[model samples]
Target: MTKLYASLALGLLAAACGGGGGSAPIATENASAPAPVAAAPAAAPPADSTIDCPMFPASAIFNTRIDDTARFPVHADNAAWQELVGRATPFTANWGTSSNPSDLQDYWGMPFNVVDAAATQWPLVSFDYAASGLVFEASYPAQSDCASSADGSGVVRGCTQVPASQRRFPFPSGTTLAEGGDCGGPSGCGDRHVLVVDKAACRLWEAFYAHRIAGQWYAVATASWDLRSNAMRPDGWGAADAAGLPITPLLAKANEAASGEIRHALRVTFRDAALSLQHVWPARFAAGSDNPGAIPFGSLLRLRADFAIPDAWSPQAKAVARAAQRYGLYVADNGADLHVQGAPDSAWDPAVWQQLRSITMADMEFVDTGAITRDARFAKDSLQAGW
Candidate 1:
């Protein structure tokens, strides 16, 4: 009966939350209010600096120590927390599951990876104000693009009042559909995620189940982030990804690759029913599963701090290993078991990439993150006044 209830909840949750498999045709006309005038492009970063990379504010949730914040709602050293990690099944690269990819590269693939800056090479189709113009709709907590509407299948179908600074996502001017949505297979129809970085503004916009019709952008869910703050997504809300987490901050950035170490945790995935209802802080969902031993979303899995990086490893791989030992990896979504995320970069060595598979779940320990506590007021405060 427990398994049966979880199964039903899973099905209902998917429909309510805009699961990756479905799609609706783009609408030429918007069903919501119009967007505001475009804000001036954000001030460009200094010549020597990159806007989004290079510097992550100390306050950013990714960079913040779990023990440092007054907002940490969980009691990290609780016995329950320790027991959770000790008993929960651990998955690594070679887990013999049908959905688990054999290689680390295949797991994240296009969901993230650096795209070439060249305009013509951008694969996702692009539209401008002069052409099929884009639309911005303000999403509400109850009437969210990713949540169920009063009707059904809570997908955002129309446009509302969104700002150009927020919605006029500076997708690479020549960005084309990389691979997703209509471009992917029926069962595996990718989320058709659209990510736009306003370098000048130092902001990021990401969407899931995205589509462009008559030049207008549409999405089932969207999220925006300020590159400067360590703010978190509201509890119980969904972001472009199912984890209700930000994707860019979690990614292995090009700058980090160049610096030879990732300072933050890598975003990872678990198959459905392998997640729990109690998300650790920094994560917004306690994505439910039938497995009693499933790790809660936002749980931190760290490689032993003193673990040695093999001498044969490349500098880039070592940096990643160092990060695992330091900041650790955070469970962000439901997908394959233990797949770490990094943006695509041609510079990656195939051998270096493969070495990541060597660092399995066994080499890691679940950090003591205290105990889980729910505060409705805190959850509301984390939300944007308007999306």
Candidate 2:
């Protein structure tokens, strides 16, 4: 008979306290009763960087370990078990009355225990968020006590027996699997086993404790849950998890920000590296603009300078200008083209200039040649304030 594990029965719990506070109202004195009183303006919403979003406590982050020895039964009618079977089956195949034996054997090897079993109901066991690193302990009670038998009509039958053991397999370690690899590969294999319980021809199970690492809300560390017994096989598991996996909004936002920052940093670093190499060649400067293969360091420098200037041009402009002067060579043309001396046009071209414009405009209101030549101190402060 097919079985489901208790670990699959646990529900994902994501709780945060306190609704957003409303803006305070402005206060004014009564005209006739008292002296005039100035009203204070409402505070602006906090910047995305400064906002203190609630985070799951470290304790809650690693919950679900308690069910280490817990046992659970499986029944045909269990919702979780049914979900498991549905996921296990290939859409192209006709999943008839009997399940594949290899699949069943794989399920039995999972790291969970079977607690109880009956025809009408199945109670799966699992840990809370605090005990496990979001891994569920599952078991099938019917299979624990059932003995296989054959009926006279060429059909198979089984009688349920009581379970002798209620021990749980060890939890899988995160390091066991490297990112982007099969579970059976050198990096993906883990010492932990998973248990499943099936009853009423359905899989009833729960998963407990899922965690979001600090500074990485979207990047979650979850226990592996595979309906297919041979989840390590390339054919058993897909390239990525299905749509059912839960995702939090905070995680999504953080990921978006991180991606942007990475792209920005990469562009900046590439430009810096190219400039360092070009500064050593003096002959390349005299053979400017006409030579397509020649470097255009001056134009490149000017473009970077333009990108550093701020739209508001406050006291910060002087510092930004200094940074630009240090790294960039200016052509003095009406800010048209940038030409790095030693590096060929292929290294820094119009496309590069466009990219600089886009990144600077999006991140900062304005950028001038002076600002780009200045030291990094002014640029750092401007960026921190969201420019």
Q: Write down the RMSD of all candidates, one decimal each.
A: 10.8, 28.8
TM-score of each model, in listed order? 0.61, 0.14
Highest lDDT scorer: 1
Question: Which runs in model 2 stand beyond 4 Å of their true positions?
Answer: 1-14, 18-116, 119-197, 206-387
- Candidate 1 residue-wise lDDT, 1-387, digit = tens: 112222334533544676455554432212343322222123222211344442235423355343322333333433454354343334332211111222333333433322223321222222221333443322222212221221112223222332222333334444333323134321344545566544543445566545556545544555655454434444566566655677766666544655776666677776665566556666765444545556777777667645678998877778777776666678876766766765554445556556766775556666654322233223322321111
lDDT (Cα, tens digit) per residue for candidate 2, span 1-387: 001121112211100112245642211111123211222122222112322221111111111011111111111223332232232221110011111222322221112222222322222122222234433323322111111211111111111122222212122222211111133321233322222222222121212221222211111112222111111111111101111111121111222222222111100111221121121111011111122322222222212223444443322222222223322222211111221111011111222232223332112111122222243422211111111
Least lDDT summed over 10 consecutive residues: which range in candidate 1? Answer: 146-155
**How far is 77's C-alpha from truth in model 2 (Å)?**
39
lDDT values for all models: 0.47, 0.20
lDDT accuracy of residue 28 in candidate 1 = 21
